[model samples]
Target: MMLDSETTKTYTRPISKAWWLRDRGHFNRRYFMFLLRELTSVFVALYVVLFIYEIFLLTKGPDAHTAFRESLSAGPWIAFHIIALLFALYHSYTWLGLTTKMQAAGRGLVKIGTKTLPPILIALGSYGAWIIATCIIAYLFLTL
Candidate 1:
C-alpha cells in the first residue's frame, strides 16, 4: 500500500555542532564584520553589568566603591574596556548606516515640501546630533 503524501515523514539534515565556525578561514570581510558586529553585544552587556555592579557597590559605601574602581584600573580590565569601546563604536557606525539605508528606502513615504531629503544628509544630521550630545554630556560631567 502507498502512503499518502500528507502521511509521509520528512527528514531534515542534521546541523554540525561546529556549523558557525565551519568556514572561518574562507569568510569574506563582510562576513567577518557581521560576526564582529554581533560580538559587540557581549561587550556592551558586560559593560552594563559592570556599571550596575559599580552602582551597587556605591551603596556599600565609599571604600567598597573605591576598591571596585581600583580593580577596574588593572591591565586586563583596561584592555577589555578599550576593546569594548572599539566594538561599541563599530556597532554604532553599522547601526547608523542601516538607519540611513532604511530612511532612504522609505523616502517616498515622507516627502518634505517639494522633495525627499538626501540619505547622506540624514546620516550626517544623526552623527551631528550624537557629537553634540556627547560634547554636552562631557562638559556637564567635567564641570559638575
Candidate 2:
C-alpha cells in the first residue's frame, strides 16, 4: 500500500502522533495483547464446540456412545488432534514472530528495537515453553 502523506490524510480515523509512535515507532504492544487474547478465545470456543459434539453423541444412547468411544480410540482422531496441535503451535509462533516485523496494516515498515533480536528466537522460545507446558498439563491430566 502506498501510505504517503496523502494516504494518511485520507484515513477514515484521524491519525494521532501518539498512535504512530505506539504502532509504528514503538512495538505494537496493544495489538500483541489483543491477538493473544483473541487467539485464546477462539481456541476455547473450538474446544467447547468439540466437547458439545461429544456430549451430544453421549446423549444419543449406548450405540452412539459406543461408536463415539470407538471413534475417539481410533487412530485418525488421534492424528487429527496432533495435526490441530501442531497447527496451533505453528500459528502462534508465526503470529508472535511477526509482531516485531509487521508494519501497520497499511503503513511503512515499523521498526521495534534498536538492536532487536530476530523474532524467530522469541518464536522458538515460545514453542519450547508451549511444549513443556503442554506435556506437563497432559501428564497431570493423565495421572489424575
Candidate 3:
C-alpha cells in the first residue's frame, strides 16, 4: 500500500547561491587551497567538453574546424587554458600525494625482502609514470 500524500511530509532547506563561499571569511590558507583543489575538476571538465566540441567541429569541414581553432587561440581562451592547466596540475599533484600515503599505509603488500619503500619514492615513481605517459601522448600527437 502507498502512503497518503497528506501524511507524507516534505522538508526543504534554504540554500545560498554561493553556499560554498559562505564560510570562507575565516578559512586558513590550507582550507582555501583544499577548496581550490576540489574546484579543479570543474575546470578540467570544461576543458574536456571544449576539446570534444572541437573534435565534433572537425566533421563540419576544415574551414569550420580551422575557424574554431583560431578562435581558441585568442587571448581569453589562452588565459583560460593556462588557469585550467594550473588547476589540473594541482589536482594531479594532490592525487599523487594521496597515492603515496596509501602506499605507505599498505607497506606490507609491497615489501622488498623485509623493508618497505619510502613514500617519497612511491610518489616519485607515480610522477615519473605520469610524465612518461604525457610525453608519449605528446610524441604521438606531434608525429601524427
Question: Largest lDDT belongs to which candidate?
Answer: 3
Among all candidates shown, the one with the greatest TM-score: 1
Residue 109 CA error for candidate 1 (Å)?
5.8
The whole-model lDDT of each prediction reads: 0.80, 0.64, 0.83
TM-score rank, highest first? 1, 3, 2
TM-score, one value per model? 0.78, 0.40, 0.77
lDDT string for model 1 (27-120, tens) is 3666556778899999899999999999999899999999999999999999999999999888888876776777789553335897977888
lDDT by residue (1-144, candidate 3, tens digit) is 444658776544444555455543443566567789899999999999999999999899999999998998999999999999999999989887787888778553456889887877888888998899999999999998
How high a TM-score does candidate 1 get?
A: 0.78
Clashes of 3: 0
Q: Model 3, stretches more than 4 Å misplaced?
A: 1-25, 105-109
In candidate 1, which residue pairs clash? none
Where does candidate 1 stray beyond 4 Å?
1-25, 106-110
Candidate RMSDs in Å, in order, are 5.4, 11.9, 6.0
